[model samples]
Target: MLREYYKFLGNRLIDWSQTIAIQAGDRYVLNFENDDQVRQFMSVLSEFNGIHNFYLMTERSGPNALAFDIDPDSHMQLVVVSTVEVTPDYLVNLRNRIGQQQGVWENTALLFVSNKVLDSINSGAKDIGRQGGPFNTGALKRNVQATVDKSEKLSKDDKDVLKFMVKTIYDGEQELTLMDFADVYGIIEKGELSDSDYIQMGYFQDQDLATYSSKEERLAENHADYVNISLAHGFGDVRSRITKIVDGEKLISDLSGNNWQSVNYKQILAGKERLKQNKKISLVYDAEIMQGINEDMLIWDHPKGTSKAGQRTRYIIVFNDKHQNKLTVKFPFDATVQDKWITQSKINHKHYTVGTHKNQLVVDFSDLKTNEPESVKVRYRHHDIGSLGFTFNILILPFTDNKILGLRPYYRVKVKGEKKANLEIPSDMDELILGSGIQSNKLNVDKTSQLDNLMLGPNDQLKADLSQLSLDDDNESFTVTLGSVPLNFNVFDNDDNKIQPRVL
Candidate 1:
């Protein structure tokens, strides 16, 4: 019976076609067919000289077994061995169980398997084995593809990390650390690096440099156009000098003027006609394509960065067809007496009155003249903005001479605490038509536009606009709906390690 058991164990190691005669004091055999059998064999082996040294073996036929030397490194006169057929699930479970008490058997990489197993694995194919011995490309591809595909369902930062991972894997990289992987796969060309790669690299270090580089590359691609416009804040109240210039009226006295009457009437008529021009401005922001912030994050604030104060600046840059003499501007929120305004000379004219209708700032430029550049600057304190960041939305309520040439919003932001504020400019700034700006700005301070401080204050702003201008809208004030971008975050640490925050 002992010899029969020995043969059974040997058969697990060798093919059933092969035979071996059991010799006394030479090879001892044990049966391990299931979890109970494995435990029983371990118990018996532990009793005799201890199962100190063992080598694991695998087979394609679904049998896994172990061979042991009671006294390894010594000339052992007795060898203990066992084998059993196991399904894929069983082998996985067995490995996990062994790992649980692997103190003595850890770091053992030596594995021996039957020629049939090797042949079956290859089916006589030599490419995968030759390129990298025993690598399962199919398994690798599926594992990697699954990870990347799943990441698409996550926030933008995760997709960036996965993009870097996918790019590395596609290059047959052994690791995600670019430095280490570069040694094996060779350095990547600057031109070949994707936007995602730069973003992922930024999280690990030199984020400003990464951001600048990504922006440069994007510009080079010519996939879209970009613009930057700087809007400043004024310290005093809205200019109150009041006057209404009607048809053929003049603000400047023309004592030496020649035929000023006809010129004044033409200007007024032309301005009215320009305001009547038809304009088309659709929201250029695509919530599906644009990346957003992730909610959960572990912040490593810059030494000079501060915590938790938030404020938003909305920019409205309008260009009419050099026609109208005055354009009325309205604020969605009430401008407290404390709020300051820095705008164009005409829009800030003494005639402009900052009134409260429905508790919001309403500026009427009745005496305003046509085709002068203008913007609104409202500086106020804000709170309750979560870590993900804030959003600025523009909804066009139909109004007259409402031809929106092009909108290039330069976002100005002030975080809770910090010495100097930062600016977040989008690479793509197109114009928005009725009720919508062509582009939506997502001011997430974690990935593409992170600042030194945890919260933003007055100085953080968007300072650029697209060059193209001119969309015509004949509708009255308050006719359109505005849309914002998707929201969430994906972040990482300095060692190029992906950071996944724990949710409470």
Candidate 2:
């Protein structure tokens, strides 16, 4: 028998294992094989040495047992000495739940375990030691990038912060205060240096810089291409008036006198073709790999026409920025709208949700039934859109590796509480596509062109043109089936640190 925080045995103790966790202040029963060590512990605790709340537990289901609750946050520390030989019944728990205060942290925790317990844990190859935070590669990388990006020009404080970040990346334990960094950069003084002197300057403003981390989320929404065309004539008043007055069919003959006829027609035709091609191509966005978003996702249907000839299509999603990781179809929910349009899924399937919300770009494959269908039902709920006048628009384009790199995403964001433009930040990884490092496929581009010409919707101009000539004597209604699902995304409340990412 020996004094230990965890109990020895009972009908319930058989489930105890060496790696199991035990919370403090839990009542446990300690069954004794011998009584001497128990008496010694009692004598040591009985000295009235301010052990205020000790209860002698005797409600054992068997003959010999001892049990009690150890008060948590107890100012006094209790040392449990073991005296029993190793037996199958004898067990020790490794995961002791200790209280930790937020923001403030304690290091140098002491864990005492019997050699037998260590041996058991080693046999299972389970190490009880693991740490979190500041060590996640992507998190740390984004944090570092944010810190570095904030300073277009570095202040002494910024430089010091940079040095601290490098040190922490390679080393295990590193701690530095603002003063320590300031001193290293020679911003410290011994003479009449006053804190209020540079209080409004860069150093003072960057005090909370260490805590500033970019929301490294892939944007949830897909990107739409924006095109603006301008037509102007700079000829004499008579020529300009004539150019403006040119009628549609007569305009060609009217402008033929000038050299602008063929060139303008070519440009107009090109623009029209480009516009048509742009509409057929589309992008779907997802998040980074191994960031705890979606675990495994696949392109269920390659963008292709149902025709026997498998015409492929090329497409791309432009990100707000470029990134290193693979753009996984699986992305975290809240991160789906972080202004990053980098990660995207190509939409070749007939029925799919493709578009961006305020912070989310969603491509839903849930309601898809067959591969033959063409037009998809798009639905959404946007955030803070009315006041700021944010409307959902889409841009479809041919996918290529170059498109991923050229992705420059922007949004018209208006702030709350003020009737002016609000804070603007660069798109996140999901804001745009990085490199389409995936093997190039010409299929995506070809398929887009082929489908755009297919005339997908019922009664749509395109559909009407492509509709087969009906020869039936009786009128039969043509029915088109559309798939839809409720698209719901909870607004990410920054005030609450509880961030939940959903994988679709």
Candidate 3:
């Protein structure tokens, strides 16, 4: 019976096309035909020398025949031959039970007749194999493909780590240090070098620089060659600025316009390092140009509007010095006295006092660091009546030099209540009537003379005489310019309804 069992577990099963192969670190169950087949399997298992953690059951509903571990220490491979046609559900339960055994078994094989059992076993194992499994060329290829498919939705940093891991695995490296893992994974602990530090150190070898004779020439050549590479791997903010410099959209100089030179690769590298160290400060603000104003000045709005008080706008200002600098925001002299201004720093929770200095409302920011952005929220209410607008200035005073850096012009205008009216010019009518209902006929305007004299010079101003028309609650007047001609008319709304006129 033992000889028959040995043959059934080996060449006999192979010849009969009943052999089963299983990967290590997985579980399987063998279903026998009857008690006789189970007894034969037991006899074969007993003949094995090093099969440890053996468990034998008398009578059970499922796979209760025998269980044992087979690994290097056991000096044997486990094989179970059975002829019984078991259900897929029963085989799954048996597999789970075997997996719960005390010790892990290596190289387990199951021979059974049911196609359902075969299907269940194939679907039960995870596509990715467990760690420390016996390596097979086909399995390795499948695992690598599986890893690639799984990495589709991973983040860029995670994909980077996976790339390093894949390269290491492909190179068959057996050992890895913690520092190596940290570097690949981009984990900057207390003592480790930052990503910027690694980039600044330069990855090119000395052998790569053998062509250059002088040190300055070598550095210049290296900088030129490394620009593209560093731009590709640099930090997010650094990449954008470097791109702007490369595209000639921005200058590569300090705020004071000093160190003005063509784009240098070393300067960009140093900038990346400085960014990492929080040596640069950025101030974000929102500004827009007035529609009617022809000047190129942008009107700066309050940091937060009345409706969107929670939203923030970011502005950037780069400095040349490494030490902390004081920035003073000066408001218009009239606006300082007529407006109630409240200022707060969003980043460091620092309190800013709006005080008058040199006939202007000035808010000073001292000891500003670059580690985190310092955003100041300015909320103000204008109390003055008939106020036009005002211009504010941002001046940065660096301790290293007496030069003051004037960033930009920050102008703000008072909110006004006004309505837009559109007028239509008729081809046949020499005079047009303006107003609502029967009262509309009271005001009439002739545009033939105005149209003839519409020629305007650069500093010319065309004004209409409206001294005879009394504009009160009963009458309203507005002027519409056609080409360059100004036509004035009065409108009366009997029902006090607002009118929107459009030019046809």
Candidate 4:
């Protein structure tokens, strides 16, 4: 029988979160590392829509294969890569060959859980605690508390100084953030307190500070300033995370090992994120470069109709093979050659202006000078604001010559002049939810020991035996294990099954 839930990792139905959509002419592809993994891939074959064809490949075909993920139509046939840590050199060469050939297939990409065929990917970061990096509950608790103790303790005077210092920075949007507060505390601890102390409402009571504002204005301003900085850093964003600490326990996630925390909160606005990218240009490629991208990458601007994220420069690198190698190619490319690149996003809710910061993207020519290139054309993807992957409506630029070209995206964060995010780091980061970064109230979990298992019937009231459970830091929580009990046939099912077997 098929189980209602499968628990390999993240979710049994990992693909359920997204729809399996294929356009009328789209072709889909599935690739694997080995025979076992290939079988695993086939096990979930029932998940996709309109899967008409499947095949296995051992050699190279054409150019666009490397540039894009060998997708034919909007659909694809699975391509398997049984290799590990295929270097940028390999990826680049593959791209150059496939990229040189234009319009052979629709679009395509290589898919693998990890370079190892496991979820580890091709790097140093370990996912499961069994492999590397501590992921167990004990490790997590120590890390959390340590990060907290390492944080700065603010003094009354330090708080006032930091608040004033930050107000000068995000003056347009309000700065006086916790970071500014931390900075002041650091300075004070370092014994550099030539500046006056920050006493919250107490600092401005003196005649010297009063010259800046009246008592009424000072109080109102301080409250407003405090409210502003607290909201942006993901403070009490979720109600479930907020609770009264009576003996330090939360209403949820209190089953076993646990920790609870709160973050700084401030006023907020509702909106989505957008990416700043290079301009669209009418150009052509070797038609092989499309292999790297299977999904159509759409460039998006903000809904507010302005982007402050990218202006700095970074190269729109095109690899010649599976490993990244700059391709030597010439074509009418429509990418921006600006020197600026996106570093980080803005903190304020207001729309960021373009050209306020410098960011850049440029392709290196040295790699292209090599004999092998990944593909003929280069491809890039970014942001939900502009383009959708697979739309393919934009003009395709061709790459026939060999020379590295640089493309740049605009960024909102200022470098060498202003700072970002220092103020927004949460005071209680340990409580953040994985993936969503949502803060949750700390839960305590312990092994249930009672053998008198009792399955609570619908509308059943739960009475606790404090003797069987261990006392937790959170007084509200107690752990108990219950056993199944014999049910009398006289009991009725919710379905009103009287004569039916009650064992079910």
Q: Once superposed on the true structure, which residue ranges of model 3 sit more than 4 Å away at CA?
A: 1-75, 78-479, 482-504
Positional deviation of 122 in candidate 2, in angstroms? 99
* Candidate 2 residue runs with Cα over 4 Å from true position: 1-294, 300-358, 370-504
lDDT by residue (188-290, candidate 3, tens digit) is 1122223342333332223333344434454444444455545544555553454433322232333113222223445545544444443232222223322
Winner of 1 and 4 under lDDT:
1
Taken over the whole model, the C-alpha lDDT of each candidate is: 0.28, 0.27, 0.34, 0.26
What is the alpha-carbon RMSD of candidate 1 to the true structure? 29.0
Give candidate 1's whole-model lDDT: 0.28
Of 2 and 4, the candidate ranking higher by lDDT: 2
- Candidate 1 is scored at a TM of 0.17
Q: In model 1, which regions exceed 4 Å deviation?
A: 1-311, 318-324, 333-348, 380-504
Per-candidate TM vs. native? 0.17, 0.14, 0.19, 0.17
lDDT of 1 by residue, 1-504 (tens): 222222323332233112233222222122222444444433444433323434333333333344443233342222232223334454344345333434433432212221123222223223221223222333334344454444323444434444554544455534332122221111121213333333232211122323442433422221111000000012121111101121111311220133222222223333333323312111111122111121111111111112222223232322333334554544443223222322222122334445534423445444433322222233322121111121222111122222222222222222211111222222233312222233334332212323112221222222222223222233111111111211111111113222233355
| 1 against 3, candidate with superior TM-score | 3
